[model samples]
Target chain A: MMKNKKMIILLVITILSLTVLTACGEKKPTLNVYNWGDYIDKEVLKEFEEEFDVKVRYEDFGTNEDLYVKVKQGGSSYDVIFPSDYMIERMIKEDLLVKLDKYNIPNMDKIDDRFINLDYDPANEYSAPYMWGTVGIIYNKTMVDPLTKWADLWDEKYKDEIIMLKSQRDTLAVALKKLGYSMNTRDMGELEEAKAELIKQKPLVYSYLGDEIKGEIVGENAGVGVVWSGDAVTMIRQNPNLEYVIPEEGTNLWFDAMVIPKSAENKELAEKFINFMLRPEISAKNADYIGYSTPISAARELLPEDIKNSLVAYPTDDMIKNVEIFKDPTDIIAEYDRIWTDIMSEE
Target chain B: MKLKRAAYPYIVWMMVFILMPLLLIVYFAFTSGDSQSFLDFTFSLNNFKRFFTPTYLKVLTRSVNLALLSTIISLIVGYPLAYIISKEKSKRQNIMILMLVIPMWMNFLLRTYAWLTLLGRNGFINNILAKIGVSPLNLMYNNKAILLGMVYNFLPFMVLPIYSVLTKIEKNLIEAAEDLGANSITIFRKVIFPLSLPGVITGITMVFIPAVSTFVISDLLGGGKYSLIGNVIEQQFRVTGDWHFGSALSIVLMIFILITMAFTSKIDKEKEGGGGGLW
Candidate 1:
């Protein structure tokens, strides 16, 4: 009888302690922020949490498509998301994003005017610019000749020595650009032409790859690879023998931006976090760590002289002659997917 | 009553993890992708119709072909190893089994990724070849490489089951077969092999199912030249955002595997009946 009374007393103490701990946890509102994997500095997030006295729940996604599917399916609520050009457009079309209040994000002026009012978020109401880059060839100078044109990728001399992108849009865009067609073309005939071109080039190609393309090139397993400009910068740093080129036939100029999801519960806190990230020092820190170019002009100035002057990080306008930003391929996306499947399914 | 209550947690787990997802897959497979609201779904056969075309059939055929080739190779290689291990002393058998399982302790993706270094142009093999004044050979980015990966990963799954069954055979039965004037080969064929049929069935299922559904191994080793059904299904959900078509493909693959399991079990039952008659 004495043991049973002691047990009841112990259980009561445990229950009271648990409730107190949970009550402590509930004191601070959590802001869930989802972004691309390895894309942040992490220190900035910690700094924001300390500054605002709000808990930040951070998660990462592998691809833009993954981000889109996760948000669209709607199990978890994310206050802030970082999506790229075409993806931002798609989310706006689906009414998945909340319009940003300029009053909350006063640091919006830090972003360059050139990066503002872009096609993805035309009025700059939905998204804040984060980082931007171009898609081009990164090649070993010792293995291949100077690659000036996208048509050079088709030359038989580089047989089993070229690494193409595994991504459907990126790979298809390469073929489309080589054929002197727009990357965002809605015409079925143009898309079919690109598909045929890829099929023809498949024999000469070494493999279709994603992040592994960097390792393959640096290890000298492949002579040439099609990669984003940011990855090119990092690869060049790893192996000085590598050279980056935006092909004369033109390529994709892409942007990644921050937006609030419509399901966000902590809208005000999310804005505070975005404004914190837009600070010159914080943006510069992220740019330095991530090896991606920042859209903030002030952040660019604060970067080290070598990084600031690096042509690959910030290409001159004339250098990218016919570069195009990817738009939401809403109408032609299904056709594009079918063509991609066909290209990948070819025996 | 205690045992029944103990199973309640597992029942709840199954309902959430297995049964719910299965029902959801069936629902999504039959529904069109056009619906905006969560509750309202337009039931349609379009997803299934899309999968029945010549292009998708080719992908399915490729996945089955690769999986079958890997399974056959595994059985041919695994059976002898299993038999040899089963014949060993108990302590030594345990050691050998531990050796087999130790490689599996490492992550599967890491193990597969390590093959790239061993098989690449400037890799360990080619580095050795270069010292001998022989040119580097092309070993990566091919179908043969993909088969090697599947066999390497799934070989243990094929071997362990057969070994356990072989070890469990009654010693007296083998002794009696020998006393009755049966040779070693004759004894194995007439007695041991028949009894081990259940293990062999399990081994095949364990290896074949995973090999058929594997996407990572094919993506890494096959060099993205062609799409397996696994890759196609993954593309639909992740890349193309067509969960309806992805669900349909998954349903079809599941049915194909179920048919395979049924056929294997029938063979096992037939063997059991014949072996009982022999006894």
Candidate 2:
């Protein structure tokens, strides 16, 4: 009886210890970050982990819409997210972002005033700008005549040589701007006009591209194409023969901002990471690597002269004047989406 | 009671992971709001109304057509390759199939990016064409690119099932057909084809469902210029923040898939009866 009792006690202890060990193994600190693919300098992440001693888990989505879906679903616990200007506006309206404590982010003072107190976060309350760029035409200088305005996309001379952004909002907005309508216009008649214009240009377009637009333009496959300023800058660096032009009629200026989601489990750590990214040296390094215009004024000052002088990074004052920032259409978004689908199905 | 207790964990897992989410989607399909905190419980048909609009309907039809075309193309290309492989010696067959499947082991996004390098104007194919004095083809961001990407991504799915069934087919059956003086074409059509019908059906299902809902390939290769049912549904949820409409689209898509599956299974059952003990 004594021997049997001892054996039973040993078996119970072994099982208890095993259960405790497994439970401990399952607990660990993890920070989840959701951002655009290829938008980050991955080496910086490695350095951050070494310095902070925290496990950083990263996830990427292909589009702003994709990011919005995951966040809106309510169960996702992402610590940090990168969203564009209009998306930030929508998220603020929906109350999806956590208000930042300005004291915790002292480096916030280094950000360019132009990026602060904008339409998305008028008080600079919920988000911090990461990068800003304009939507413009990127062209191979040798093959195409100089592009001056959004109407150049429809010019018969460049028929089948022009590529446009595949995004309904971007493509339609350009047309609307060219037609002298507000980029955020909700008027059904104006939207219809834009739709008609897109259809007219449809036959002349070589293709509609997003990320691939830069590479295609650089390779001389397209004479002129609508492209994001960041990608345009990257392409022009690779091929000196290429030039980026902000259409004289008007173009969309977009800013990507970082925000801490309400569902974040590591809000404190997320704030720290955001502040670190704003450090002048770090911000300048990111701008140099990504080739996107930085929103940090101090960081801009620190960049090499050539980078600062790059026409793609800092367009002429006249060019900047011709650009209009995109605002959240809110109620009229559905109308735009509908018109877009109709146009896509026409062919 | 004892049996029920033993099965409790599995039941709970299924309910929590699968049933709960599906139920939530169905519920949200009729409700409105961005977040759960703001959800209004009033039932509305606005979501369904949006789906029935002519614009969305056109995209749905186009998606169905694309799926059908991809299914047929995959069948034609994959079945023969599978058949040929199945006839080879066992060791060589294993090696060949492994080679075919190796590409799938890489990340899907990486493979899609590889196609960008291959199809771009300065890409390999275009460079070779340019060297030969032919004009560079605009094949990277259009319907042709979309179709090529879909077929490339899904061909393995088609090949695997048909190959499995073909390999299991008894060699004596084909020999028996030849003994009865049936020619090669007649033997294949009457014997091999019927025996492999189950795999062909399975492959069709595997290819069609994914092709219809494929958003990434279309976005990446087609340059997001085209609208498919998947893209429309995705935009509703993500871009417009219209969960109700997105859920409605999802439910409609699910219904369409079920109807197609039912029709396929009915045909499969009929075929099963006509084909003899060739299982």
Candidate 3:
């Protein structure tokens, strides 16, 4: 009986230990990260996962709007997101983001001073800059005449050969800049004027496009196209026949930033990840990989000479000195949206 | 009791997924755009008022026109194909149905994206045209391209329902008509076409509703220039952060779809009651 009792106890003990071990061996905590498509280097995610001993779940959204809707839908709990300036402003106003604890992110000093404390997040809270670039006209060298201003888009010579940005704010901003007004003009009259201008210019535009603008430029489908500087960088490198110019008329100098949402389950992990990304080597690698300008000042040295010195990548200080960034339009956004929808619907 | 318990989870799922969302939309439709507070339900007709703008009405009209066009095209293309398939042997019929369904296995979005590359200015078709010493056709970023996409994607919807109804049709009726000295055209017009009325209605309802509310096709092929009701609703909810307006537009769209469905179903009933003899 004693021997039998011992065997029973031993069996129970072994089973209990096995259950405990199996439970402990289950999946690691996953860090849910949402970012723009093709915005990150693949190896960098792997590196972060290995360094942190946690699984990384990365997802992509096509636009700031997509990112907002997905986050609002509550279908998934995302820890970190990368949204552009105006979107960050909207998120901040909506109270969708948490006030980031800067103490946890000590590498903040590495960011270029010029990128710090801008219009979107003036106090340097809630967001950390990831990449900085401008919205400008990228032109085919041999096909188009000399271009210097946003008004050049309306030139008759480039009629049906000019591609415009499909975006609401970016396209509207072009007309607003040409009119020598703020891109974030809340004036109803000024907005009406701007809308009229876009409508008048619609015939000259070949097609209002998004990413396909690059392919169109490279294929010589369009003589000139409105594009982001980072895209221009990549396109310029691919074909030497392309040249990017920040229009003489002031344009948008936008910055995209990393932020932690209030719904993040792993807030500490998110901060750690942001700090990890802020490390000089990682920032440089990301900038080099994405063809976007590094926000970190120290990372410039780590970049290849060509990328660091590329005119498209690094614009002269005068170009961006008085440029505007998008603000959270709030109720005024409806007007802006109305203009875009109306413009598209016009026959 | 066992069956009821088994069904409990499904009921809960329905309530959570379907009924709850509908309720939320109804609630949002009537409320103000400032949804920052739980008690901020300050109700208004502003969303409805805003929707009636000339611009929005134009978009609505365009959506209806395109949806109607695509439905007609699908009927013209799909009805013949379904009839031919129904005439096949059962073994061959099954294979033909499978072949029709196989293309849908990839994805609707992927298929639409494929059209983007094929119809683009420097795309394959344009390349071929260039090689043939013809100027490349300006095909992309237009209504024609969107119509093509809508017809291609929704043709399966048009075919499947008609095919199912046709296959169910008894052959003896057709044979009797033929034995009575009715030719193929007379037999088809008198017997087959009348019976297929319900299937035709179902197919139209399926294809028209989806085509009307199609955002992706318009965005991809229409080159972001053509703004339909779907794109507007999407922009309102996603881009503009205006749920009140989005939900209101959705309700309006829902009403339009519902009216169409009711009209189609009424016609279906009349046909059935009339024994499908109307020309």
Candidate 4:
């Protein structure tokens, strides 16, 4: 009986190995692309796969930190990844990314000059801009006055009606901007003041939220909230009473960019994928579908007139003059970590 | 000896999957920096020291309090239901247990998310209240909401074990107690309750352990306004990239759980000893 059991196990193992071998024999060269959830049009991927005749293995990540951990752990070999500005800077510093071969990506010229050579990648050598947005207040116009300043979020009348971003940097930026301080301020005192102001505002906050912020505002459960401009645009479309504004004090202007990781085995195919995405038509489809600002100026022309004129998506230069792109906080991350812990842990 | 040989695969599985990860957690808990390699090591008590401050202690206390409250509430609700099920016919008992287990088969996160829609300010409950001319009650994003999530999710853990023990109970003991001129309440107190102590202890441990370490339910139902100990450890690992501190907090929690187990098992042993002499 024991020998028969062993024979059956051996048979099963042989069948498994045969299946694995057949799977490997029929495989095509694959390019692994990782990006934010629901950030791209699915049809663009199908088009790229058909045109290139290569298998496109697509994955989505919830946050920049999740992407960082996956890359840093060396568990997965992704050829292409999309990470936000601060994360891109951190990756470049850690030598986790390969410099982009700009000559191969001829479509780079179509990208607007304003987005090129940004603070995160000053030389524009390591990454290409994918989407850009600003952090701002999205409010229910019926429940709240037209908010022009970040301080308006702290009004007592909106007690248990205000929603704040659960993220560390974005929420802290609101307090910093309200105080007329730099959003990327590294000064310990400024940070402490921001922490204090947030704790004081904690009681009035309906909740600290991430993606759920949109649902709350759209449902009119929250009077106002700190929201990503792109998300605000989408929320306004869902509920007409919702309005988005870039607070007068300005906010964090952030960018998500495509970069080839150092671990990538298919650099050339990754570059091809990037170039295809940067094409005005593909970029416009993505921007229009996702409701985010596209960096390709040509893509902007192709966007419908209403979306093209959206102040939330494409803020005027005057509105963004006081804005700051987030810098990597490697120097005082411990302080930021402590301050966030303090805020969350406080009664 | 043959039975012991049959257990070899399981022992090896436990060592590789359970023992190794625990050893890694301990190793990470002692180290200070972001050193990924095993060779260059600097050991320190700073991670534990950092966790003992008033802010983190408050979070730890909150986690314990909430977990204890949920465990107690689960027991209060589960014990009676379990007792009733135990008294039912054998076929009905299986059906009732199967009904309880059905929700557990669904994803825990999806089940918790469903509660958000049911309890949100603009959710179904509030909508019904609005139609009835009552004001919308602030239901979601509060301590009570979090407690509801915990109890709802972990109630099965509390019930199943107790039900099993209650069913396995020897019928002769209750008959003997009744024959000794005991009323129903007196018979229950003298025989069945004492016999079910083991299951109650198991149920408490099962419920409390998971509830204390839960972060998702709090994040979803509590609205991230409240930070439990699990949330702090999750923050350190996921957001702040401070694995050393996260590992240290995990070690502390493991020790806390170990102590609770020791206390409960001692009670279990004493009861067994007291009952053994009579048996």
Which has the greatest TM-score? 4
Output the TM-score of candidate 2. Answer: 0.85
When sorted by TM-score, best at the front, the candidate numbers are 4, 1, 3, 2
Candidate 4 C-alpha lDDT tens digits along B196-250: 8888888889999999999999999999999998998998888888788899999
Residue A264 accuracy (lDDT) in model 3: 92
- Residue-wise C-alpha lDDT for candidate 4, range A1-347, written one tens digit per residue: 99999999999999999999999758877999999997999999999999999899999998898899889988799999999999999999999999999999999999999999998999999999999999888888888888888998888988888999898888888999999999889898999999999999998888999888888888888789888888877888889898888888878899999999999989999999999999999999999889999999899999999899999899889988888899997677667878888898776
Residue A338, candidate 1: C-alpha displacement in angstroms: 2.2
TM-score of chain A of each: 0.93, 0.91, 0.91, 0.96
Give the winner by lDDT: 2 or 3. 3
Per-residue CA lDDT of model 3 for A104-161, tens digit only, reads 9999889978888887788989999999899888888898887889998877788878
DockQ of each: 0.72, 0.55, 0.55, 0.69
Candidate 2: stretches off by over 4 Å: A1-62, A66-82, A97-115, A258-279, A295-297, B1-13, B170-181, B273-279
For candidate 2, what is the DockQ? 0.55
**Candidate 3: pairs in clash:** none
Angstrom error of the Cα, residue B73, model 1: value is 0.7
Clashes of each: 0, 0, 0, 0
Candidate 1 lDDT tens digits, B1-279: 356887999989999999999999999999985534646778899988988888788789989999999999999999999999999999999999999999999999999998999999899999999999999998898889899999999999999888888888889999999999999999999999988877788889889999999999989987777678899889888888888888999999999999999998899888772331211
For residues B23-141, write the lDDT of model 2, one tens digit per residue. 98898788765445544567778888888888889899988988899889999999999999999999999999999999999998889878888997778898999999999887777
Tell me the lDDT of candidate 3: 0.88
Cα deviation of A74 in candidate 4 (Å)?
0.6
